[model samples]
Target: MRLYKYYRPDFYFEKSLRYDEIFFASNEQLNDPHDLVIKPYFGNNKEAWKSILKSNAPFDTWCLSKIVDIDNDNLTRELNDEFEGVVVDDSSSISSVLDNQSASLAQIFEKYLTPQCNAMFKKPEAASAACVQFLKEKLARGWDKRYYSCSFSKNPLEPQMWAHYGGGFRGCVLIYRGLSDGSINLRNNIYISDSQNFKFADVNYQDKDKLVDILDLNSRVNIIEQNLLNKSSFWSHEKEMRLLLSESFGSIRVSIASGMPKSTKTQIFHHAPDAIEGVIFGSNCSESYKEKITSMLAEKYSFLLPAGVPAFLTFDSRLTSQGKVEINYGAKCIIREVRSSQVIKEILENERLNTMLKELGIPQFN
Candidate 1:
């Protein structure tokens, strides 16, 4: 899993300058990089984009940060870099699906069922009409075969990340944050179980060129707005939410996304979720910070917690002598089946037994 995390130059520089700053807590201005709104810098306006890029100087910086590398010496090496979404556009996940037939991602799995999928097919397939036509016929028959199980990310609030890139693209991007914890960085493993979060159109769009087209700004914005505006999608989302609680156990994800209403005359938006799964805090986090967040979640989002929603907290000096940390995402609950409470029980015992006895001043008894 060679995952690369993207960071704006300014965010990266700030992290470097203040190594222990807990940057996620700060109220400084932050943009949804993938769906940013920099005035005339909207859509594919090349001149405005160029100006924004020039202002950003080194542009965006991506780092080779793997869970394995988090504790290694190489993690400290700072990178200086451009194209906030260059790596994302060139992602092999996106390319492989189009190139590999086994993926079957070329087909629209469903129609008008999802406004996002409908708007995608409505686009002119310019450079790859053959692929588009094939998809249209395949989808017209109401193809229901699973086209993909992949990751996608966007402004969880405004999903325009791929609007200009031929629309109906989906995957969990490297960055995602709820309004509650929107400050977490690329180091976090942001995964999405698309089973309920998204529906890939059953159309196979093979022309990478067409998929990469810089669409009209208005068109791109409209596609995103349509996704939000799809009242049917929200109904489906509500059903999925109820079904998730009824059918799932162990780990899950709960996301609060910004949705558009069904009316074209009004622009009011509301918050909803795509669900949540196993989540762990970054090792750089402070204990007090952890407590504050846990308290907030318990108070405001208690309904989201399942039988055992796990929390992975970084250790304070009181826990160990050397501060060595082992990120336990291998049991991420997504990749492998997490069957029991053994892992959680073990963690609690390791973190509490000795402290309990010492604090109570109990005699060592066999």
Candidate 2:
């Protein structure tokens, strides 16, 4: 597979070309406020409450106290009145009360009883409140684990992409060759045991909201997918993909460098050298910027390809009759006569290539 990352000719582009760095944005730093937001769903009934209680007992008691203002003193008395010889297991009655009494109870329930339940109570509403609070806290704990991602697109020729991500056709798009349909090779410098190194997911654009089943304690992977892989249909134009990296569990290191002060919010990683297939400059990309980039590839970053094989470079020129950007995929390099002095100097300095030039009747420089 191939992936495209759009970039403006800015400091970030310079850093990426110099360091071969791919930056992952933290979930909180994403542009969309609703991005990664998971709407947790826990059925307001006995089964959900039972699942909650099985997870944590103390949290259950705490939720009950906060939501209904009930204490240990009145806990048993309230339980007897509400449950009425029932096993205190049938929580459906309590949920029904929460549903009718407060339409906002569902939201409150998620806030309080997010992950688990433990305490028993007299009033069904109070017990329901406690269950809600218990689960809420548990879910919050799980959600606190930090996540970061770098986005990519399947298409590079789209004009809208050029406008939005490519700085209004003045930037460029990086191309990467992947191992499979949606996978890319990304390795970090610092190792964090038990943490995910990297994973690629093709973005799924849908109109429906991502609802996480908070009652299922074993659904960690599902939660991550729902939050990261899914996007609104409005973003479907991008044909997006993502590379995700998770922070090491229980570790405080935010950047891949570890212990070093982070100068930016981005988490950097070095990609496999050969993964970089080529670069396509936008229609309005400056000639000087193109020269700088091609020079870097010709000199320091030549290791990206096999010897004698130049990395592909092309200019996305003026719009075609179809109103689509024109790109000559046959173009092998971005060399321009405007910068011919430096390029020719470097070519002539190479003994192997200079000999070839002489054989072709090219004038020899002293």
Q: Across residues 1-366, which tens digit of lDDT does each residue of candidate 1 receive? A: 011112222343223212211122100132212211111111233443322212211111211111012222221121001112222232112222223331232232121122333333454232123232232222111111111111222212121222221122211112222334221122111142222232211112121222221213235433432222222222221111100001111110100001111212211111222123212233333455434433433332233334434432211211123432222211112111133222221232333644532332321221
* Over 4 Å off, model 1: 1-197, 200-274, 300-366
Question: At residue 120, what lDDT does model 2 achieve?
Answer: 43
Question: Which numbered prediction scores highest in TM-score against the true structure?
Answer: 2
Displacement of the residue 292 alpha carbon in candidate 1, Å? 1.6
- Alpha-carbon lDDT, every model: 0.23, 0.54
Worst 10 residues of 1 by lDDT: 249-258
Off by over 4 Å in 2: 56-141, 190-197, 218-220, 248-266, 303-310, 333-366
